[model samples]
Target chain A: MSLEERFNEIVREYSERVYWHVRRFVNCHEDADDLVQEVFLKIWRALPSFREESGLYTWVYRIATNEALNYLRREKLRSALHFGSVDEEMLRRIDNDPYFNGDAAERALSKAVVRLPEKQRQVFILRYYDEMPYEEMAKVLDTSVGALKASYHIAQEKVRAFLSKVD
Target chain B: MVRKNDISTPQGYFDELKGRLGDIPHRDRRGVRIFAPWMAIAASMLLAVLIGNFILRKTAAPVEEDNGWDYISYLAQSLDPDGLPDEEFLTDVEQ
Candidate 1:
């Protein structure tokens, strides 16, 4: 197959998965859309020499994770400089968005997840929402299976604690 | 007392979350622009290999130079003495 054909096929297969990965980090659809596109763009450019040393899905996940983390970091800095606080108001607007399907409890859970340190949040999302196995997650995260399992357990505890407080 | 209405939040919350996520525009392939640096590096490597092969093939022909007998004798001496040519005596050859 031609390079472009292979590239297009990959984009078709993984775009939504990439979007959800970014959305779990950003918790906003529009931002997730933008970040997912950026992830694919990076993948396309890097694909020519992407030695198939790892599964293609894992490679894409790695790119999505990095892009999401960088987006969050940049957003945090931008908000800190421009608005003095991360814009809770804007996030609340997203909460009020008609398309948001999560109930109050789910939203509360999501907010708690968002409050987590970046790595912990990523661990939680990949384990819970994506339903990924610890081994596969280790490949994408470049962490050992033991470490990922520990991180997921800790993240679960944090989420449970936060939710129990709301209860 | 399990009540149907006992759920804390409004009934539509999950539906809304799912709808929002679902409504997110699928990223179009045409929208993504590949990074340029990777292509540039690949192109340069290809060009270098091609140029290197061309230069190597061009220079493949052996060249001969005129050197005194002593130089030849030294080269011969570097070989095993048993294999030395009888045509030249090592000592007689001018340094």
Candidate 2:
């Protein structure tokens, strides 16, 4: 198959999955839409250089995760520059998002997830939302499985604490 | 822990997104990371030049308002320089 054909197949397979992955990270459909485009563009560019060191799914998801994390980092910096809180801004977006159909409990859960530190947030999302295996996540995140477990533990506790207060 | 997705997109969003994304290899064959910045810079420079030209033209003195040199420059540009008056004649005229 031609490289373009392979790329198209990859896009058809992963675009929606990656879109949801990034959408959950940003909690805003507009930003998620833009980021998904960027993610696919990156994938297309890097497709030629793929070394096959990791499974294709793992590799594709790693790119998506990294792009989402970088986006959040930029948002945090932007909020800091404007003297606003990134967590609050994200919570606001989630609350106001037209695409978000979550119930009150789900909304609260999402806000709690957003409040976690970046690494913890990513870990929680991958585990809770994505149901991704630790081994696969480790490859995607380049973190040890033990560390991911610990991070997820800490993240779960934080979420539970936040939910308790809300309830 | 319950795991369920609470987010939703408009109908046919993914199909549309996939169509847009599938063209990346053809549309952005050169890679966005490279071309986007350079395109932005080139665009900015072009805009700046255009704006600068516009402003300069707007603020510039009109060509009809000769500062006493246009006549001399015009004379110098004549193909038949021999027919034009010499430095002594111009100095006499200026005085």
Best by TM-score: 2
lDDT of 1 by residue, A1-167 (tens): 87667776776677656766677777666677678667877886788889887899899999999998898778779888887545473457447655467678877877778767788988998888788889999999999999998998999999899899989
- The clash numbers for all candidates, in the given order, read 11, 0
Ten contiguous residues with the weakest lDDT in model 2 chain B: B84-93
True contacts kept of 1: 0.00
Where is the poorest 10-residue window by lDDT in model 1 chain A? A85-94
lDDT of 2 by residue, A1-167 (tens): 88888888898788878887888799988899999999998998898998867789899989999999999989999999999998899999988988778799999999999999989999999998888999999999998999999999999999999999999
Q: In model 2, which regions exceed 4 Å deviation?
A: B1-4, B30-95
Measured by lDDT, the strongest candidate is 2
TM-score of chain A of 2: 0.97
Worst 10 residues of 2 chain A by lDDT: A15-24
